[model samples]
Target: MTNLYTGCPKMKEMDGRAVLILFIMLTLVKTEGLVSVTTGSDYVVTRVGENQTISLDVSRAGGEFRVSFNDSTEYLFHKFNNSDLKRVNNNRTLYRDRYRVRGNITSSVFRLTLYNVTTEDAGIYECQKFEGNQRVPGCKQLLIVARNPSQPNITGPASAVSGGSVTLTCSSSSRSLPPDHPPLTMNYTWKRNSEEIQGGGDVSVDGPNLTMKDISREKAGNYTCQAKEEELKSDWSARHVLDVQYGPNTVHFNETHDKVTATEGDPLTVRCSADCNPACTVTWLDTSRQKVTSGQREAVLSIPAVNRSLSDLYTCHVNNTHGNKSRNLKLDIQYGPYTVQFNEIDDKVTATEGDPLTVTCSADCNPTCTVTWWDTYKQRVTSGHREAVLSIPAVNRSLSDLYTCHVNNTHGNKSRNLKLDIQYPPSVKTFSDISINNITRKVDSVSFLCVVDGNPKPSVYLRHDLTNRTYPMTCETLSKSIYTSHQYYECTHTNENFDVFLHGAYSCRAENTVGHVDSRAVVVTVPSK
Candidate 1:
């Protein structure tokens, strides 16, 4: 303490500036000697804008104290001592804003606390003890390390098309440390959406630069980076958003089961949309391939009334300048039966009797119409299906009738007629019984008649057994019945014996294109032979 005023003028006589110079010079000389002779060294780490309380070991140092801060240079940052520390202090404003020391003036256990530490504060610190204004030999060597780097920034393409490549980089200053210690060393780590990311096939990392290949929409998110140096680290960088521009990925329909359904004479509506980046356009096409809506993100198709003709395919197309896609939508328009008619374009179906017969009835409708076959008597005889099949294993003329094909839906109904015409061979019937006839000499001029029935009147004939031939062609169609034919064989000559009479055997034959039939034979005999 005597050395501070040994050669200096009285405190009131000297200029304040000169007094400060002398004090700082004296502190520097003492600190220089203490650092060169001190063998113990300590360390401290702090972040910028943060306060650090270094627990310096001043227990070895006693009495008055001298604290000096340095950056390993010839000059010293000056000092802090017990007396005149704040009392009558001048030009020591650096101590008030950046540092504060607290302890009893006579105590050796003192603490140093740095306020709002900055990058420039990283340096060496020296502490020397004194008693009776002479050096005590106790000393300490402290190293302060400060880390403050510029806020990390990420630069890269803000947006890109799918399947394209992308590159990004994180940058910050590395000279955050002071001159006392080595330059600040930093390593970079990247994260996306707050989750750490590694480098591999899809992503490549080299130092601070990160690259991504074949980028897709699924890989888009917010990215950030951090600068790290050993245990010290800087705050995370500002978020850099990566948006991948792409065309419409897929199309979806608002309708259920991807289909539109409506009953006959009812309204219908269909809607479609797509997923894309820049809001894609949509187009709705009808069954005729004509656009119903175009150049919109969403589209709708409306129909006032629905029918079988309106049941068809529709298309929903979504597109952008990059590409386009289309999906087909089916409109199942339901309705009652229509265009009802029989098979072969004829209302009548002609078939031979005793042969299999089949008749079909159909109509155009959506959801397939419920069909039934009804006979002329209004009897439902056929199974229900899209089309009616009236099947008969063996058909006969008795089964011929007019059949109706009836179809019905919740919306409407319709009916069609089909005539079943069954044709058969001629059927013959004889009127008189000649098998028991006793034709004697008195029974002259006896007659036989026959009738034949068929679709087309068959030609009728009479035959005699004795001649074994159709000798008499006397059968003719009846005047009263157009389908009937008659035959008469008169007994021209009476005979005494069964063998000598014309009544020995008589028969009738009826024939048409379909087939032929023969009637029962008649025989005559004499009594009391």
Candidate 2:
């Protein structure tokens, strides 16, 4: 009879009953091969320094089952059987006290517990009935993923100047792992004020290094870093506060108004301030570039009894550790209506009688001076501020009087006089009679008289038509008047002197710088002697 066991050729000569017993034993071994192993899921993940249990279920199993763990390389690390549960292979002693199997061999469910898991314990685990050292193909694979994450420590400058660059390095303490275990790769993430920081713009990241370019006050905040390995994440690291220092951005008066005005002899105070980090040193400078020592961040420029000399540009220089900045403050000091003055070369004005006259008055004052033109009678002719013009059209002697420009302000008042001189052409008013009693006889004395009016006394003369001769004459001015009386010419016939020479048409002429005027002719005739 042929042997029922294929590998037992020597048993071919044995008894058939013995062959039947051997076949029964082989059949029992095949029946036990139907054992199926399963787990809760296909994958298992656990963090380092934590405990995790992988539950296994075996279906229809009636024999001793062997459980073993294999890495991604299919290398066995641990094994458990009905008789004993222990680490095996190269990691046997490495994970000696870190792993345990809980459950009786007769139970349908068994658990593989990992305590204080490490990176080296991550791999696939197989549980199946052992068939004489052969692993069953139906065994389930439990992929265990062990993770070790670390809290990242951020290292960089706590303070940075605005517009500068800074780099923060996220570092972590080395993780402890089993001997001969693969190295753990870690990833880093950055956060600011609890918000995730994205790469781009002024911020960029490379692995564990984070760079911030062109930092500003807006970039100042609390920053933190976290380190991750596989699916395990660590807690956020301690916050690193960034302080951005800068200059005094804007400087101006603390008051609402930027410019201030003060009257002469009045006390004035100007307060200046600036916006800056790390506090700014503020100093006030006068127009002369002299520093006004004061406190930092604010400077009070005080002026006691401000005058025109005190009016100038005041600078508020603000300086800090970051940079420097300055602002200009204008100080206006108002003063008098200084003595009313004329822009003309001289205050005395001369114009023709029929011409127009304009007299402008200008004054120096802080709040602008009020100017008024007053005549000798103290009557207001015109009023204006700073400057005023008194215009007289076709001015005559009546308008030619002592005119004064009065300038006044809150500070003081002043007056300036302007004398107007009016000039006109000479005029012949009247001519005295040259005939005696409307009749002239031979040897009778004859004379001619003329009256003239002009701005200045004019020269009077008489012209004889028949004789074609002119006789210069003398004049007598009327008191406080522009008129004058003069004897123009005289002709007398005495003895051998004939009256024929004196008998002629005579006229009077008055001449001056302006012009000359001639009077109507009066004939000097001698009756028949």
Candidate 3:
């Protein structure tokens, strides 16, 4: 039966069967593979001060395959898996496993946005493809970086007036953010020394300036400007120095008065003053320039009357917390132009003719002055005399003259006239005595005498040769006598009658309050019995 049927329908059945086989072959997947993934660009460049952009593309085809963008980030790409996709493996799920229509092809692409991109982003990025525990492709690398920002410049004043405002400006030549990501937010910190300053609401972001109002002395110091973005902080700008100054508060002098001489019944005034801020203290100084009592604030110092004894240097001192100043003035007093007493004169005098005679006229006055003497002949004689006499070789009847004497001092000058006469007496007598009394011996009593007769009586004394002891002689006037010797202990006097010290010499000296006389050394020895 089977043989007969196969022969009868061969042509018709063969054509139908061939058509069905062709349809089945057209619907079936012939091969399983993947084409390489690609990006919009293979290379990327960026500067430190600027930003950049990049896009990723993955165009490939296969049966039941899954695609993923393995970014450097652990979370990988923000996923966009088609809802109809199923799990190909534990690590990758089937996305677009089966297309709805036969021969219909499609591709998947991803966009990555980075903010504040830096050199750290320069590395490899994986672009992987998988199908049911199989790998079709691998990841690729993308580079990113930033160009260095320009240095900042700062402008400001060294010092601002007190209670005035000061402004500091910090700017950069090229200021920008990277374009690969959104614009970065920048941070600014204003500082003095190392301390950050607190700005009022007056801060402005765009200008990066710090404006301080009502500046005071405390507001002086160094300043710095800093700009920061992400993890990068910019360098500080150059430093600035400030100073403030002012003055003229006080004045003073070392002295107050300036008069050298003032007569009695005259007026006087002195000044002691100083200039200073916050008012200076005024004080008077004595000749020593030391602060003295009695100082008043009178534009001019006035003394009602002056006397002869007020002579000294007066000083005015001005002082303040800051410093001291001083001024000096000299004051002198003067008085008296009169004389009080006259000179004394002897009533009689003896002189030879044409002999040189001398007389003195003394007077007391405000100032010492000169005196003069004259003769009755009106001829000027030797000046300065209380007693003046005229003489001739032998008193001629013409040997007469009225002598005039004058005395003067700073007080006033005066003159007086007087007559002089001459007389003579027997020759004045004086007595002499033996000068030597050198004999040395122990004596119970001794005798010596000196006698003289003149206009005045003269006294005598007895001195010991062995000892420098002097004894006043008391006896009837013009009498000579002997005196007994007495021993004294603890007396400064040493006697030659006593042995000399082992190594010392002994002598005798005699003296009156007016004159001295000494005797030669006298050696004495004891008789051994």
Q: Tell me each candidate's TM-score.
A: 0.52, 0.51, 0.26
lDDT of 3 by residue, 172-241 (tens): 4333322343334445677777778786653333447788776665566787777764435677766655
Write candidate 2's Cα lDDT for 1-529 as tens digits. Answer: 3221233222212111111100000000011111112223344344455666655554333334445555132223222222233333434565656544444423345454566666666555655444544454545444344444567788999999999999999987534333223444567899989999999998999989999899888888999999876545788899999888888788878674656777778988888788788888889887788887668778788877788866378888888887788878877777887566787648877777789877789998878888998887778999998899888878775553678888888888898888777777777767766445434365445666777777645677777777767778766655542221121222222112336557768888777777888889987667765
Off by over 4 Å in 3: 1-261, 288-301, 340-529
Against the true structure, candidate 2 has what lDDT? 0.64
lDDT values, one for every candidate: 0.61, 0.64, 0.41
Candidate 1 TM-score to native: 0.52
lDDT, residue 298, candidate 1? 81
Residue-wise lDDT of candidate 1 within 1-529, one digit each (tens)?
A: 2212233322212112211211110111111111212122234445566666544444444323445556222222222332333312335454445544443332234344566666666665655332232333434344444445567899998887889999889997654456445444567889999999888988987877889999988878999998776445668999999988788877887745676677877877777888777678999887788888775778876777867665388898998876788888877777767678666658877777789977777877666778898876777888566788888999776663678888877767888888666667877655444333454554434455666666545666666767866634455444532221222222222222334345476676777778998888876544433
Model 2 clashes, total count: 1
> Which regions in candidate 1 have their CA more than 4 angstroms from the true location?
1-147, 163-165, 174-183, 187-207, 210-214, 224-238, 247-249, 285-292, 321-326, 345-359, 379-384, 389-401, 409-412, 419-529
Top TM-score model: 1
- The model with the greater TM-score, 2 or 3, is 2
